[model samples]
Target: MINLQGVSLHRGERDLLDSADCRIFPGHKVGIIGANGCGKSTLFKLLLGQLETDAGRVDLPSTWRISHMAQEVEASEQSALDYVLDGDSELRLLQKQLAEAEASSNTDGHKLAELHERMASIDGYSGPARAAQLLDGLGFSHAEQQRPVRSFSGGWRIRLNLGRALMCPADLMLLDEPTNHLDLDATLWLEQWLQRFPGTLLIISHDRDFLDAVVDGIVSFEQQKLVLYSGNYSAFERARAERLAQQQIQFEKQQAERAHMEDFVRRFRAKASKAKQAQSRLKALDRMALIAPAHVDSPFHFTLPSSDKTSNPLIDLREADIGYTDRVVVKDVQLGIQPGRRIGLLGPNGAGKSSLIKTLAGTLAPLSGERQCGEHLAIGYFAQHQLEALDSNGSPLLHLQRLSPDASEQSLRDFLGGYGFIGDRVFEIVGGFSGGEKARLALALLAWQKPNLLLLDEPTNHLDLEMRHALTLALAEFPGAVILVSHDRHLLANTADEFILVADGRAEPYSGDLDDYKQWLLGFNRDKKRKEEKSSTVSGSEEKAPEDKKTQRRAAAALREQLKPLTNKLKNIERQMAAAEKALAAVQEKLADEALYSGGQQEEIARLNRQQSEQQELMEELEMDWLEISETLEDIRSE
Candidate 1:
């Protein structure tokens, strides 16, 4: 619930938000879309009250709570849990006082009662219990949670801040390109979380799909004014296009009318009776506060320079053993790609995805195995850690000019604009860029290079959903063999023709599509859950699971139904056993808590624990049986 009335803002010689009026409502998922240096971030400062407005006023409730994540964040040497717990300092302080009050059982009954009530009112103060829940939800394990925040990377720190942002309940949340540092799964989790978040949201992101899924309205920054539409990005685009067309026509008509009115006044000022009419028309004309109609332009549209369609194979990796120093990460790999095969390297973090890409780019020598590329096969590589790769001494434009000396001025601008680096952004030092900006710069250079083969490693790292799609389309159309390591599901699905999954020390021909990859990933996580639920050593054992699990039991049951005709009936029996064991686990957790343990409950707890141990073994046996049956079915079904 805020409003900007006649906001006028300027940056240097350019007018950014000129006499703009905008409204942000409660419970509205609003996304701000604009080109770089079009004053998107500048508008944010105005809303943040960091800058003074020369004209107009921003109206918001005095008691409204707000959070801002600065571009350059400094993280202290605090533990992950400690950092997130500090989000609501008031609540944490209240919790501390509540603990003190509880520990000291005083004779002052009235103060004790008040303390208990105040403690209950505080949020996220379950101490370890609440901290563990938040850490787990953010995909951090117990080990990661215990580790100090300094051990984490910059991206993870941003995530830590994001977790803090979500922990505090606010009326409106301002996110400036939140998706920049997050991976695909993290992005999906956040998308789902924000969709369910109960507040008015204002997000500035280049991700079209994320915006489409989340926002209820699109606020466009054009013609130095704020144009608001009542729907998501797609709706806004269609409406904006129509509105622009209408405005152009209206502008032309109004100009003609104004000219006619002026001409009549000029011609008839000397006439007696017509002089009054001319003066009246002149007064009306001067009062007309016409808007300078905005000429609509497409944001990102660029085509690669068509090079000779050479017959040379773009890249080849035969029996490649790619790794760092003595550690062999990926071995026994064979790949041959020519100019046109768009390949996507799919795998999790620390899967040697980057190493493989680097080895192919000839930046690193393989530990062992033959590798060769065809004649005239030029490679353009875009590294994920672009900040390190950039020439720290050079200006932003100078870096690109050094690589592509012959590139025209417009060529650079057009390419830079696609990645949201327009105008003076190109003049700033490369080091001044945010993580997202640096990533986008690498992308812009990749376009300028115009190489025959492209090796993009995690190119979607800081890209919004829209920019990712734009890249996908560009790569798909380019007459080049693209071997990219990306975690963005949509980009991989759209841009890549062949999928190479680099994991477990191999890169094999993955037959399944992106949908199939997603399905396989889901099954993998489900199986992981099942393993995590296992509590003891069996005849043959595997990974350890959590102490308590409900979803794991469900998947186990589904596996049993698939083996309905089995004579062993091991599947169905184990499925039921897992359910019983889970209920047993709940009782054990209750016993651990020591909360409201009524008399004569000891025997029941022991019985449940015994059943849990027994069920663990049964499930292991059934899992082995299911594995055998599954292999057998695959063999039979192939024929």
Candidate 2:
């Protein structure tokens, strides 16, 4: 077990943790959650022994190996695979020793055999394959894995760092926002991988669905204390909500009592009959410990204001080909945005989701096709690059003031406060702000524009959970149309009324939810891999002695015959799962109706709840069956 007893940590004058205590058991997956600067990463640093606590101690088994994802990778010419393999220091050392022994002039057979045995014991020979697998799972292509690490972009380098961390063999793993740089497919892949990880894992993530899917417990930073809660993020939220509700009740009761005492003292202090009673009441009020109000609300509370002018169809694209000057990424795109339309772009990385958003925003013109816009169309485009475009010297107030110079400073500050830039924070320079803070400022600037159409690309990249929830709420309540590209599944599910899949050199409407999209991605990747493998075999056969076509045809026919049943079974399971999901969604939609929960219909509500549970169980079973058959098919194909 890992234990922190009376741990107090400080950064400058800020008290990050005051007498915080948390105990984590072996093989337990826990999520560390808090606001941007609440010491989630700092706690990981303390565990790694890079920072000492000001008071108390943190204890973990000395024999337990630790692995953590690094925030940054140093610029190097090292191949991505080699860099990942280097994560296993002991394996590398053994290989180095084995090489030296084999190359020595004396040729020490005994030493060479011992080194080889040790290497085998550790399965060092399979390190490269495992490293490649990690890279592949993280969205790296076969050719990309061999490229120099420094040659990739910053986001790709971050993926390399994640791959390296996974390559290391350890008992405890610490991951901080691993999905921040990943897309929806890669995020789903990582979620599955982490679920299968046997080690004790502690991940700090703002993505609620990801955390709920992976972590068994939650350790939240609440008012300078680390409070460990049983179950996942949703459970923690419920528990915390109940606790806060009780606290609020107590606070209100105490406030009433205090008010009565104050009133009594003011009315009877001068009277001889009640002078003693008033004095006693005054003393009682003075000695009474106050119960603070529950601070359960999110700090962020803002909306994307809609334009006053009307736009029936905000933007229309017909036969549009969007991409750079060299090539088209998405072809024959036909999309129209109308008032209050919410569309989420779903596709793998580099599938032109951003390119489509850019084209709609007028930042990138369609390579070919007719683009039409409403006369009153106002676009508020937000992307990760917008965060960088922010003036470092300008404060939040200054940034907003630049948008509406005629507006009062008080009004602007009030607007900034909705984005969690309150009071002194509004005057703080953007350069000193953290990524989450900078993201908030960028969002604040966008929200102030009152755009009729909002184009947001991964807007939740650096935002915390509260901010994400706020953004979701804001988007939900916004009157204008929204086009969102985000890996945060919760946000996508809540904000997007429909999905547009940008893939296969085309942009088309996806007739499925996030779950169905995931299944589609799996099939898409499998088909793509099969095509690549077949192409490789064809190319290799041309350069070598030709195999007997009759034997090859027989072998291919047998493989197909073998895969036919499993493929049919997989499709059947998918269809059943889809039906179950649809039924569950219908049940959930009914449950969401206010009238269903309003005073009556208890039996009906219970019936719907049972139906939902049954459908969910059916879905889970179908998914497991699908996975089993898919794995079997993959094993056969590989063989």
Candidate 3:
């Protein structure tokens, strides 16, 4: 448990947090939220003793354990499991001593006994089992457990660090955007694990769904203070809205009072009969200082630039193999994205979602595939590190001018203002901008292009929940073909017409409906977990028993084995249904866009919808079978 009493923190002449009081209790999960650069990370640092407390105290437990997930990570030469094993520092050391003792028969008798005791203590605690459990939960496949950490990319290394952090014995855990790089299945698994974990938790995430899934409370920083809401993200959002509306009403009442006082003074000031009244009103008006509630102007007006209607057949890929260097992330895929379609690329990290989008954008060359584009499709490609890739020395105005050379002065200023860039900000070099600023700039550039085919890769990064919602709406309204890769499930649900889940060098189309995709992801994960448990088995001799624990265990194992293939069959069915439904949605969005504009090629929506309905019915039947099998297995386990 931790508490902050009258804490004030300042950075570079600006107050990040001011005299804020808060309490974080054990066994309760909380989420910390605010606009970017509003002291979320700074508050974490202050708690961790990594920052200075200029004014007050950050009270913590007399003896406590805390682990904060780091944004940056460092590890090399070790495998993923090896690095994560470092989480239990004492256990790692103890294990080393034990290994040395076991290797030698002759040793200092007294020292050997001590080392044996320590090793026995660690083994009894099942420390290694705990480490392996955490690693598996965080999505490290068994095959990659012994692979060197140097083989993984930076994002994967971050996951390793996260696992290490989680493996520690902590009363409180602090996580910042832990789900940012995780896939749907992995995020869901983490949410389940954290929900069942007994500890105090504080997480900072921009994801609405993830916040809702994991937190029991929300603490927000506004006006240099912390405001508490005793509920998850959705509940807090509703409460915050109500509180704002109440404040708005109070503000209006005060404004009216001040207006009345000013009017009375103006009317009575010139009349001797009303001189006393005039003076009284003047004093009242002077004393009446209106309270302006703390607020922010959600900037960035993102509307797709006016684009001409697209012709049919937006893009067609034949035998596509997309990747960088000599490795192919995805290969031998035949797919087509039609005009006005809004499709989302879904997959685990390193599963080629980004690569597929880049290939579609023509930014990356396919190793062997033939890609054909429609006659009038102009692509607006938004890279993951769009703003970071900009020329840092170039001012905002210069960047805008280079990106949109035909824009008039007034138009340029208006566009910049929409993204919260005022006069001076527009002239500031890209190097000086913050993460949020960079993201806004990339969006602005994309909107200015008015491309008929928009390729967006993780555009939701660095954006707040509201901004993400707004972007979803804008993309939904876009009169063009959109192919996006995003970790935000809500955005994918609202904007994408279909889901293309890439994995293991192949693509499986799923119903673009976000909820549908989630259910499928869950089933898939459950199946994989069942398989792992089944594989961790031992051969047993046939033995008759009247009734015993071993007999029950054998029955449970048998039930588990019977359920595996059935569950796997269900996953395959769900995959088919998901793909059909997604393609239907894509057809609908495309048709709607075509109707608004002109000359778009694509499959007919009616036919697609009919096919999707058939797939849905078949999938429902398979799900029923799966449910029966799972329930029967549970019954066996319970018995």
How large is the C-alpha RMSD of every model relative to the true structure? 20.0, 12.8, 16.5
Would you list the C-alpha lDDT of every candidate in the order shown? Answer: 0.65, 0.81, 0.70
What is the alpha-carbon lDDT for the whole of candidate 3? 0.70
Ranking by TM-score: 2, 3, 1
1-639: candidate 2 lDDT, tens digit per residue: 999999999999899999999999998999999999999999999999999999989999999999999989988999999999998989999988878887889977888888889899999999998998888778888888889988998888889889988988989999999999998989988987887789999999999889867787899998999999766675466445435545656546545644644554454334423333223333332222111112235677677788999677889999998998889899988898999787889988789999999999898999999799999999999975788899999899888888889999999988888888887988998999999999988888888889989999999999998888778657755888989999998777656767888899988887776778888887777666667667757353346566799988998999999999999999998889888888978986785464653444656755765575467557756876887798799879987
Candidate 3 residue lDDT tens string, 87-188: 877778777776787788876779877876776765635776777777777777777778888888766777787888888767788887787666666677
**lDDT per residue, candidate 1, 406-480, as tens digits?**
888777666677666678877788776665577767777766767788888778765544455456546645766
Greater-TM-score candidate between 1 and 3 = 3
Candidate 1 C-alpha RMSD relative to the actual structure? 20.0
Q: What's the TM-score of every candidate structure? A: 0.68, 0.83, 0.73
lDDT of 3 at 142: 77
Shift in Å, residue 214, candidate 1: 1.6
Best candidate according to lDDT: 2
Worst 10 residues of 1 by lDDT: 287-296
lDDT of 1 at 376: 75
